[model samples]
Target: MALRIRNHIPGLTAALTILSLAAVFAAVLGVIPQSSLPRAPEPLIELIPHINAIISTIAVMTILLGVRFIRHGSVRRHRAMMLTSVGLFIMFLILYLYKVILKGPAEFLGPDVIYQYIYMPTLAVHILLAIVCIPLLYYVALIALSRPIEAIYESRHKIVGRVAASLWLISFVLGNVVYVMLYVVY
Candidate 1:
């Protein structure tokens, strides 16, 4: 009889754990009243355009980290960056969705003229990318996690990793751009 082993990556579980926590936090926040919610820096809009600025900044950091990890040829770190980016976006999505679910989908900010064009595309693309990317992430995670040791890193993981990176970057960058246009520009 032979024992079987799966492919292993050192830090992926930890990254997932952190992401899970963020997701859970967002979900929890959704059902609770603001008075009952844990304190953060104030809610995003009340904090002003600075919140969008921060998310956009993190989006840039995620891209830079991802590119560096890929160029350096660290498959492990590359996966970490992608996972982290996805994790952050998950956090963003949870918050974004919570706000929408709680507050309704129309903007209460920016001038009417700019808000009209500004949000329509960003909102459509953000939503479309989200719908598409969720399934893609599931499959990519499956491809990464389902294989055995040698199969994990040197083979399927690379393909899945590339797909994950591209999808996540597009989603994240577009999300921030949408945020900027709505909050910062107009």
Candidate 2:
């Protein structure tokens, strides 16, 4: 396994929670402008979506490879994918927070009722759960690394797959939707 499965499940879970919350708090508190490097990279909104694309690709690969590994009973590769996906996600979050701090809040497309009711809720949930998923995602990955073969292939393990897929889908889809609205309509 690429990631060693900690027998101390509770401790690992708690550590994951703390890590995610710290990142969220950092995002919310607003990094000082001086903390950001001006010469590092100007915020390129156009290139940003590519990061999301990469993440979505990684997520897809992880899910597919994970399923395959389980079926074939290749524990190591499955563990690799799990670790790789989590690494990609953490990298995504760093870039995301950097982008957000560099630019500020999301650009709303419209103030209409439809935007308020439909768009806002979707966007809010997308962002919030994306943060929450940080820990859950890692936990799922660690489990895949640690769990027994029988458990790995079970429907129960698929629960983690479902959650990962749902969160990544919402994040990617809503991201594209918001991007389109901001750049095209608003």
Best by TM-score: 2
TM-score, predicted candidate 2 vs. hidden true structure: 0.69
Cα RMSD for candidates in order: 6.5, 4.0
Clashes of 2: 0
lDDT of 2: 0.65
lDDT for every model? 0.59, 0.65
- How would you encode candidate 2's per-residue C-alpha lDDT over 1-186 as one tens digit per residue? 433554655578678789777766666567546366453455575566566656756665675776678568777787677676667766766666666666665667686885888778777876786766666676676666677656766634568666775676567566656555655566
Cα lDDT of model 1 by residue, 38-131, tens digit:
4444465354334544665686587579768878977678667666766666566556545544453435377776657766777677656655
TM-scores, one per candidate: 0.61, 0.69
Model 2 CA lDDT for position 21: 74
**Evaluated with lDDT, which candidate comes out highest?**
2
